[model samples]
Target: MDKSVELLKLGSKIRELRMAKGLSQAKLGAIVFKDQQSIHKVETGEFNPTYIYLLEICEGLDITISELLDFKK
Candidate 1:
C-alpha cells in the first residue's frame, strides 16, 4: 500500500481508539504536549509525525505502539 494510504489508515485507527476512550482531540493533545490543531492534522493524516511523536501519542492514548499500529479491524 502507499505510504499516504498507510498514514490515513493509521490515523483512522488512532481516531477510533481515541473515541473509544472518550477523549477529545484537545485532551489527547494536552496529554502529548501538543496543540489541538496538531492532533487534528495527525488524525487527518495531513502530517507525518516523528517516532517520538508517535510514542507520545501512544502514551497519551494509554496504548502500546503495537496496539496503535494494529490496524486489523
Candidate 2:
C-alpha cells in the first residue's frame, strides 16, 4: 500500500475512534496538549505524525495503540 494511503487510513481510524468516544478534535487535542488545528490535520490526512504523536492521540482517545491500529472491522 502507498504511504499516503496508509496515513489516510490511519487518520480515518483516529477520526472514527475519536467520534466513537464523543470527543471533538479540540477536545481530544486538549486532552493530548495539541492544538485543534494539529488534530484536524491528522484527521484529514494532511499531516504525517511522529510515533510519539500517535501515542499521544491514543492516550487522548483512551485506547491502546493496539486498539488504535487494529482496524479489524
Candidate 3:
C-alpha cells in the first residue's frame, strides 16, 4: 500500500478504537494535549499525526502503538 493510504487507515483505526472506548474528539484531545480540531483532523485523516502525538494518544487511551496501527480492510 501507499504510505498515505496506510497512514489514513491507521488514523481510521485510531478513531474507531477511541470511539469504542467512549471518547469524543474533544475528550481525547484533552488527554493528548491537543485541541478538538486537531483530534478531528487526525480522525478524518486530514492531518498526519506526529510520532509524539500518536504516542501520547495511545498511552492516554491505554492502547499500544501496534494496536493503533493495525487496520483490517
TM-score each candidate.
0.94, 0.94, 0.87
Tens-digit lDDT track for model 2 on 8-51? 88899999999999999999999999999999999888899999
What are the per-model numbers of colliding residue pairs? 0, 0, 0
Per-residue lDDT tens digits for candidate 1, residues 1-73, read: 6988988987898899999999999999998899999998888889998989999999999999999988886
**Inter-residue clash pairs, candidate 1:** none
Residue 58's lDDT within candidate 3 is 96
Mind sharing the TM-score for model 3?
0.87
Q: What does the lDDT come to for candidate 3?
A: 0.84
User: Per-residue lDDT tens digits of candidate 3, residues 1-73?
Assistant: 6867876787788888889999998999998788999988887778888889899989979999888876753
lDDT of 3 at 14: 82
> What is each predicted model's overall lDDT from 0 to 1?
0.91, 0.92, 0.84
Off by over 4 Å in 1: none
